[model samples]
Target chain A: MASKLLVDIHTHVYLPRYASLLRSRTSVPFIRSSTSRDGKLDERLLILDHEPSGGRPVGPQYWDRDEKLQFMDKHGIDVSVVSTANPWLDFLPASQASTLAKELNEDLEQYCSDSPILPNAPIKRLYGFGLLPLVPEITTKSLLDTVEQISKLPHLRGLIIGTQGVGKGLDDEALDPVWTAIEAAGLVVFIHPHYGVDNKAWGDKDNGHVLPLALGFPFETTIATTRLILSGVLDRFPSLRLLLAHSGGALPQLSSRLASCIDHDPVVASRLKHDARYYLGKLYLDAVAYGPEELGFASDVIARSGRYQTGASVTGPAVRSLGSQRMLFGTDHPFFPPLNSTEKWKSVVENLDAIDAVQGWTQTDRDGVRGGNAVALFNLVG
Target chain B: MASKLLVDIHTHVYLPRYASLLRSRTSVPFIRSSTSRDGKLDERLLILDHEPSGGRPVGPQYWDRDEKLQFMDKHGIDVSVVSTANPWLDFLPASQASTLAKELNEDLEQYCSDSPILPNAPIKRLYGFGLLPLVPEITTKSLLDTVEQISKLPHLRGLIIGTQGVGKGLDDEALDPVWTAIEAAGLVVFIHPHYGVDNKAWGDKDNGHVLPLALGFPFETTIATTRLILSGVLDRFPSLRLLLAHSGGALPQLSSRLASCIDHDPVVASRLKHDARYYLGKLYLDAVAYGPEELGFASDVIARSGRYQTGASVTGPAVRSLGSQRMLFGTDHPFFPPLNSTEKWKSVVENLDAIDAVQGWTQTDRDGVRGGNAVALFNLVG
Candidate 1:
């Protein structure tokens, strides 16, 4: 069997500077320390946890880039397209947001540039998707300027964004300029979800991270993308490329249902003209789905949907050819950290297992999902 | 191509009596009419819709059994194991709850028994999963008695239940006797979701039934079943056969994540020495998934999990040799109604397409999902 390269496109890091900013805040997304049951001083960060308790312990692993490189080495990840973990700059003051975004992007860029500082660093090892300032009351001009500045950042490939846009959502018409600028800059939008659905949906019992991490994250991704689709983001910016986390977050499974829904509603149908399946070919998906069966199914759906777009003039063959290149490997690292004391991250291994398990897949296809896709999409190896 | 016998085990009906009850009540789950822009009466229902206009139109097709038969015939469904639609006697007063359940079960029995009254009706064509009077604070004795009474009804095959159990969820220890009795009677428990996750998960946008129906329904099913697993219902009632709607409502997709979570949490791991994947084969799934690839993937996951039990024994093959017997056909009728003008139900046909799409599946396997599974599980033909 040929050895295939493994890439982690969805890995997260809290830069040292970013961590300091979070520590200065009193609200959520902050870190603190508490007494453990063993009588040891344990640090805790409160992102989702609600209480007067200080946030979860912020350690060197969270902010230190060397720690990230060391962890990647431990996991056998060849190249990681790291991005800033949420809630990223959404709460910044408008005046300071743009400068802070630049600082964060530069900080990330420097980390990627210094990738070879560590010994035994794998070939073509480090790359990044930069962050954007998405605070409310921020002018569109400022947002567009940030996009332009980040586009030129040498190691920066794309921008990672949350679902909430200026407090409303991605659907708000005000954010169109941002989309247009990103599309014009030929940058992929790494759309991830932060604020999950209402807590009431969880019911009375505390299921720990089961409800939020398992359901909330994906559910939020699905809703956000659906809203964008309904609001005509694809129709408006046909060239816009979005890399959805968690294998399009149930979109492939629900695409047929969504298409049927559009077909049933005459008002929506007349306004939308084409079906939801039509837009699916244009969208890019990540192989963050846990199992190989899911990965294969998602790939099959992409392949089948690509067939539908064959006849369209401008978008037909280009979009179809992009099918294999459309999906990249993503590991939601530092989040689903191994609770078990294993040396290797189980989360990362399961994802690699999925890539290995996709049957009848050519080595080229395997290479594409592992590292080649990210290389081509983000121009990573240049 | 060989002709496949398509069975629909997931279909639902409101029944005339149930519709009338809804009409009488002014609260949620009730029906009312509002004047449209053209001054015409626009009927609506308020389960997901919260407007004062109330719920959607409660038509004859929702309640009338003959209409259901006609729908089945039109769709070429060989057999349908029908169940009452959601909010099934869940709101009845305590004193009258069980009596009303008896009345409804009797009505369904008569309907199935007298199917000869319909034109060109086949013998023993219609069977049902009966309703449980789950509301009004019934005693454990009465609940068990109700299960016993329903089992004795000739046309009744099993019991249909919602997530809520005496106001708490399925995990509540108080519901142990109910699960025990239902398992002992060899009656299949058709677990469905009525109350979706909180509406706050849905942002302020009228996507017109997209969020609740698409995401909420499946998410609710996943949560309820996870609770059951965490509470060790499957461990105790090994014989309990659960037919999950919506292709186990994202259970197949999230099983890996759930297993990882259990492995990570000491509290969860301490309770059960076995892995979470070991419990999946003990449960059964319905073919309500909208696509063929999804169905195939779901089946593959069940097969690979290696959790199947012969009876109550947890240690065995991951899946039984009776693969098709474990899954049944379902249409989810009365809901997802065709918005377009068409004689054939699109929802039913899509599911049929899924059944036809599963690769390498044999005719016997197809037959079992179509009708034979329901027949054996519910003892319908015998």
Candidate 2:
């Protein structure tokens, strides 16, 4: 509120060390020299099961800190709490994962601590949410050690994780200590989605990223979050702060239906003290949903979640005021880059415009979402 | 809205003929004898892959015409546009499917033409949305013939279809003729969800029906609708009118994101003439989303979708005046039955209450969603 600061917490990066690791592997999540459609050879990053277009062209923007800074400057983003993007060392061998994750975390920490683009300003332009090595057979001690290390990093604010946890899922009881460690450290857990539902399950795949990124990603987030709720993680680790990508991946709208189903199912009903909607109140979301109507709905759902128990009104005071803080600004940069270089990135412009598009939202609400929220939530000092 | 008639468009019924077919089948979508927890034997309807509790218990409420009438009376619903419940003769053999569909359509027509529960009422108390066989290897002639037959049926206003079309999904190009036939007939295509996402995709199913119904059903709807959009079905069959169950199955909220993703992707963007959000203006949604915030958001998104094209706003008149005729009222009855005998079904109460709970929604908007929209959209006559 004091000054304008646009922070993009949803931005991503792959450190030089991780890029090297990818370059060495031929499997998925690997980078290799491939001839472009126009016959130019470029290093393309193949991190997923994209069919038609093998993958995207990867260059400095993915790993170069200077490029990230340039992108921020271009988009008017003052600070960024970047994370090691998805497929992040999750596939490393069990023996190698822990050590690699340590290296990656350190590498990201180094990236964040680099000379600021605006050293004259009192802001850290590149803080980060570190990554954990969720390998099979990973010990709770190892996980907690990583959490401890991430929290101690001078510029790290939280830990970023995929829907998977310790090879099982976030619902795995084995992840209790990991949740406890992160919660105790008072760091946010950024939950992003990768490995959407089995590609074959969709029947056909001619639509390209439309199926995976559009439907698969959000559905994955929805299922993972629902599983976490059903397994009582929210109840057990009440302090564990989860920041879901894509505006809780359809959770805001589906929360009531989820709660209604739970109350209807005798088995699920006996498990939860509160309805599924109640847990939404405790979760944080990014304003990456790309529409003001969706964002406003997500905000109201969070406020109305504990409707029966909280007795809170969901007018301007609750959803807007509270949401302005909980729903921080984010642009999933380096992913949806503009097709035309001359124009501003649609992803960034749309997200920024979306913050203003929210109906009935005041300037204060806009300020909170634009940067004031990330300032307080991630403790970004200026 | 003229005399305030309360119509329920999302209601369902399992006709005697369909029940007879299920009773004969050993596979899913069957009605069979099962022992209750208290040790009494009862006929249970197993329409889905629900674990722990095999499937919901069913009896007279599921079949008996009088019970449906009584339930309608209890709920104060004036006219009910019933459809054959999900898995509706989908499993019938190709040879039998067409014949059985004809019988079922006739059966439904007879059911609707029966004497009104209230003789003094001018409108038909019961109307029906017919079912298409959509049998495998079926010729286009067969599909159009069925559409023509349904169109002739006096009380049959629309057709209910699951996400799967001819085993390939609604995107299957072979179903083009059927869509054209239905469009030409001016019959609404009620796109409902069944066979949710593959069951194994959810991992261990300790959550009972929570994952499948809450997440699976809607996600299925989302994917199917997205496929339709991506394949340019909306552009090809521009006159095709669709009534999406579960509030367009999260489509309204995700439409902008879908649009953004489409705009970002080369393959998807190349195929579509309109942005993905524009499809919302062309689709009808049910009020089954279960919260005022969700409904308001759905309404807003649909209006905003046409914002660039229509240039009309989305506050009161723009949303309700447009959304009123687009979003209809529905009670997914006999499905989410009340857990107790004394209380009204949580499904009904939650949905009705959701309409009132939407912030800034006017009385006209409420009426539009409640019944007026259904009457206008379905051409339900007096």
Note the chain A TM-score of all models in turn: 0.90, 0.94
Off by over 4 Å in 2: A1-3, A35-41, A117-121, A310-318, B1-3, B34-41, B117-121, B310-321
- Model 2, B1-382: lDDT tens digits are 3337778899998998887887887768788886779998788788886544766788877777888888888888888999999987677777788888889999999999983844545678899999888767766777788999999998999999988788888889888888888989999999998878878667664887888999888988888898998888998998899999999877777777888888888877888777788888889999898877778777777776666443445322225345545788888988988888667777988898888776666787788788878878888764
Error at B74, model 1, angstroms: 1.5
In candidate 2, the residue pairs with backbone N, CA or C atoms under 3 Å apart (3 or more residues apart, or in different chains) clash, namely none
The DockQ-based CAPRI class assigned to model 2 is medium
**After aligning candidate 1 to the native by TM-score, how far in Å is the CA of A230 from where it should be?**
1.7
Writing each residue's lDDT as its tens digit, candidate 1 over B36-139 gives 89998765666544532234555667778788877878887766777888878777776577887887888887777766432233336677888878874887
Local accuracy of candidate 2 as per-residue lDDT tens digits, A1-382: 3246888989999888888999899988899887779998699888886544777788888999888888988988889999989888688876688998888889888888874844545778889999888978877788888999998987899988998787778898988888888889999999999888877656674776777888788888888999999999999999888999998888887877888888888888888767777888888999998877777778777766656343544333236555556788899988988988777889888888888878767888788888888888888763
Where does model 1 exceed 4 Å of error? A1-4, A34-41, A49-57, A117-124, A307-324, A340-342, B1-5, B33-44, B49-54, B117-123, B307-324, B339-342
Per-candidate Cα lDDT values, in order, are 0.73, 0.82
Q: What does candidate 1's lDDT look like per residue over A12-31, in tens digits?
A: 98888888887677677676
TM-score of 1: 0.90
Shift in Å, residue A84, candidate 2? 0.6
Per-model TM-score versus the true fold: 0.90, 0.96
